[model samples]
Target: MATAREEPQTTSRARGDGLYYGWVVAWTSFGVLTITYGVQFSFGVFLPSIARDLDVSRTQAAAAYSVYVLVYSIMSSVSGALTDRRGPRLVLAAGGVLFGIGYALTGAAQSTWQLIVALGLIAGLGMSAAFVPCNATVVRWFAHKRGRALSVSTSGGSFAAVVVPFLAGWLVERTSWRVLYLGCAVMLLVGLLVASRLLVGRPEDIGLTLEDELGRRGAAQPRPATADDGAGATGAGAEVSLTPRQAARTTSFWVLVSIFLCTWLVVFLPLVHLPPFAEDLGIGATVAASLVSAVGIGGLVGRTLTGGFSDRVGRTVSLAAVLGVQVVAFLVFAVSDSLWTLYPAAVGFGFGYGGTTTVFPALVADLFGRAHAGALTGLVFAGAGSAAAVGPFVAAWMYDLTGSYRAAFVLSAVVNGMGLVLVVVLRATTPAHPGGRAAEPSPLRGTGQLAPGRRR
Candidate 1:
């Protein structure tokens, strides 16, 4: 009995309430994250085995892992921009094809070089396309439960981190490494298919609004930008006005980069080195590998808790607490020679590490604005990725030279502590972006109102 206008409005309201396509988008994206990032994270589990079977140096095999991180990290800006322009379905589908091709080709590799190019370069590029775009898209669709939605989506990465590595590691034991690649291809393909069906750039495409969905659900509402938020929200959007050249000119940017870089060096150190480190401590190989599983478990809990809590507390305080825990975890790793100590270290480090993905995005959105968050966060992440590129090689070289991983662990702790200092410095230097709401240029102007306190 609804009139024509009322029917469309009613449908929009229902969809906005997150009763239909929003949840579908969340779960579809979740499948992709769980699969793509899962495969990416599981590299640590396969590192030792790949080295032995291929007769390559551990450092050499580790470089493949480094490549994925580098690609995924460096391409965030481009991918985010592309997602905005084209849409998640195309981005994700293309990523799937490329990722599958990378893995499929990897199955034919006879040398470490081949694996690096295929898994590292090609697969990494695919991940870049799929992962960040999906995240950005999901964030666009659900403002109220953004924390919960993002936490759920990102936890797919953690779940895959645990399940893929353990499952792939076991498969390698029974079949071959090549078969493992095949499995990755299958998962990636399935994810791509799901994305085609479920993914959209934003609720507007489906005639829905986030406020309609989550607002009706009575989810926690994000504070609207007010005069106070203007300084923080300036210069954030799909395309960064400041290229690398202009961005490099800012002291705040460098300080932020320094903080992110130092933290990442330590992040991958434990992620890539933990399995080998555990084995060195007299833990059995399977059990040592299983310990890697714990990292994923810890990440799931950490990201969920941190994302939800940051909504209540401020983003800055939540970030500081998470990073502080990371420092403590590193200290534990540095001194602990036993499995008992190492177990706790893994839990703490994994939690802190995983929490970064959730916290950093929100931080970026808060400081700049979601519009610029994609590109700005991409630039910020590249710094961290660059640091990650060097960490594994350095950790491996140090272990080889010293005949022990203790020094490496100690060094990681020291580096993390340095990052802590940078973060403090960043906090002290308040941003000057005209309150949190920049005056919109003609091309970018829209009807959406800035949350209160953002407009000067």
Candidate 2:
């Protein structure tokens, strides 16, 4: 393991309000996610221009993203494992360099093949370093406050979704798409490289204890206990963490995989194809991009609102709500021909999409425990989120075939409905542990505590 850089125990926590350094780590990670995701999602706004410039078909342009998503999702496993072994600072620094180089090459690509190689493969490899390492590292920093911290960190994508597409829309109108891409390259290179220096892997890594941990444990507390519950419970030594390998061996993990797979398979249909869909309806370029912004706006509300809301209602309830909203959004898109309907549909779509990203990772931590959170979270995200690659391509292919997005929209609703059903049925179908007790609702169930208003 990479040695953590030394700092005074009070180094990041010297704030007057006594804000923990974990928040700093969380927000810093937020900055990186915002920029990366902003540029990624804004690809939709740039798609028409890119397709026109490269003399490529829409399906070909969409395939670039499909390849990128596939490569990025698969690479996340490696990045997450690396984050656990080497620390996020090193992982993020390397990612920044690779990510920047990929964008620079993307801006300069002369052909479809080059675009795929640059953005699809190279940039995807770099992006794999972003979600897993950033969120996973934050998990190591706080225990009891994990869900809140994660909501803040992941909201960068939502915030970026809100702002970046509009910014890209305006800039694309004023400048060449290539120029806009080069600007992103410069920012990713400079921003993540500098920000990585501010990260500390864990509170204990620097000889510091969480405020709640003081006077609670001796010097020899296990790492998992520090993460499973902040300061842990009475006889904290009894708590255990599931390794990524161990997590894979359990049936609950596969159920999570299925839940996420269904949601992610169609989540990107609107984000990647919505702007073009709006344009097909005779909306102006900038206005079409604003459709993306609408999604972002709802996403901001969803993440900020639902992230905390899930803590009270339980993750399953929160997940069901998110999927349910998406089903409605897709149904509206399928049935409505009126352009105005899209605005609300887009907002609802953003709400569901944003909320799922927040709850699922927290659920993984809640179920699997947090000692190897990076690896386990990566596993879930990679296994299911990889399906996100298919949405854009399928939508594009559908558009090419039928000259309408109606069928794809209907398919998306069905898929999201499946995910909702999976989350609902999950609690009952989970197998009992070898010890003859249920471990599926898992970390919460293991503790013999139901969410408020529930009977055991």
Candidate 3:
């Protein structure tokens, strides 16, 4: 405990040592999320096996996953709040234990009820810790590098999507699903437990300032952000300190929530429906599956490239660009049935989705400041993240009512357009004297919105 809390000031002690320790935190976060998400996503591969072995209906068996999503999504707010007060160490430790034991229990279960209790409740509780703490902690550690740091951390899920399911399919062919779950339990336990030890809550705890950690003196200062820098939320280096409650009072906070709600609402519709949509057009099952891989690969590329791009351009401009890409992708899905076109559309959707996720947190920190980043980020996620669960279901419903997926695809494009418009509106009309002229003293009292000087 002491060693973890008192992690060496390796990033700031000298430049000769190597890269900043925040990068270490970012990579560790990536590793932990990879294992956690890989295991979580493998649930689909296990679903049919579990249903057959347990003698349950597919819907009955799948209810466990639905419950798991609901539980994890709701628990994120609680975990995020915990991260703010006690730091990530204790939160991650608890999550590791819960996840490990829960998954192990899932392996041993003989009934659907046990599956629900173990995976849905216990493992779901544990899954909540994977995202909020890791990204929020990284935010606390870096100012100039926040976007790139979060991009690295956020890409873990995409990487897992690309690799884990195929790996699970291969492993399941060789062994029972129970055995796979047990193996995953072991992997997640080791990965997350070790990661908990590597993370620190903030650099200040180790006697470092943000600048010192970036580089000696001003040598490591971020190259000035481009003119689009403050377009969506905040100008460079301006800080806002607001608790979750405090943030909730501001229009910008709600605007952010709405923005993400719109983003997430359309985000999963394609991922869930694309396979069938392709198959409906008489594409081979093998080709249909490959489209998912295209999305995953595009996601990996998007986050890797766009995080640094957001750092250079601005989170808002980057967000608008990606959202525009999404609008295009959905329109493609709406208007076309060609194999050649669908492949690129899938990649474009994945790229937009991946970039949106990476930008979300960096924009949060930029607008709200890092002081209450975990709680703030968590609240927005809690409010908006669940939209992912709905988008697919709603799209399916729309498909059921109508004969074709065209309407659903068009609807998604429209919702995506709404989000894009919100992004533009937010960037354009923010009051130059935000919070009104009577606004609180700044150190300039600026945060949440940009001032004119920021443009210069």
**Which lDDT values do the candidates have, in the order given?**
0.68, 0.80, 0.75
Better of 1 and 3 by lDDT: 3
TM-scores, all candidates, are 0.84, 0.89, 0.82
**Runs with alpha carbons beyond 4 Å of true place in candidate 2:** 1-17, 210-238, 429-456
For candidate 1, write residues 1-456 as lDDT tens digits: 445565466455563532556666777777888878777766777778788888987888887877877887788767776776787777778788888889887777779889889988888888887657777776666544666677777777777766766676566667877778777887787778667667877766755555555434334345543211342343312221333343446565576677778888767787778878887888766667666677788887887898777666545556677788888888888888778888788878878877776766555444444554456666787666557878887888887788777787778878878877776665554333454433221112112232332211
* Model 3 per-residue lDDT tens digits across residues 121-226: 9998898898888888988888767788988998987787667765775676678889888888888877888999989888777666576555664454543322
Q: Which pairs of residues clash in candidate 3, taking residues 3 or more apart in a chain or in different chains?
A: 442-445
Q: Ten-residue segment with the worst summed lDDT in candidate 2? A: 447-456
Among the numbered candidates, top TM-score falls to: 2
RMSD of 1: 5.6
Is 2 or 3 the stronger prediction by TM-score? 2
Backbone steric clashes in candidate 3, count: 1
Error of 3 at 283 (Å): 6.6
Q: How high a TM-score does candidate 2 get?
A: 0.89
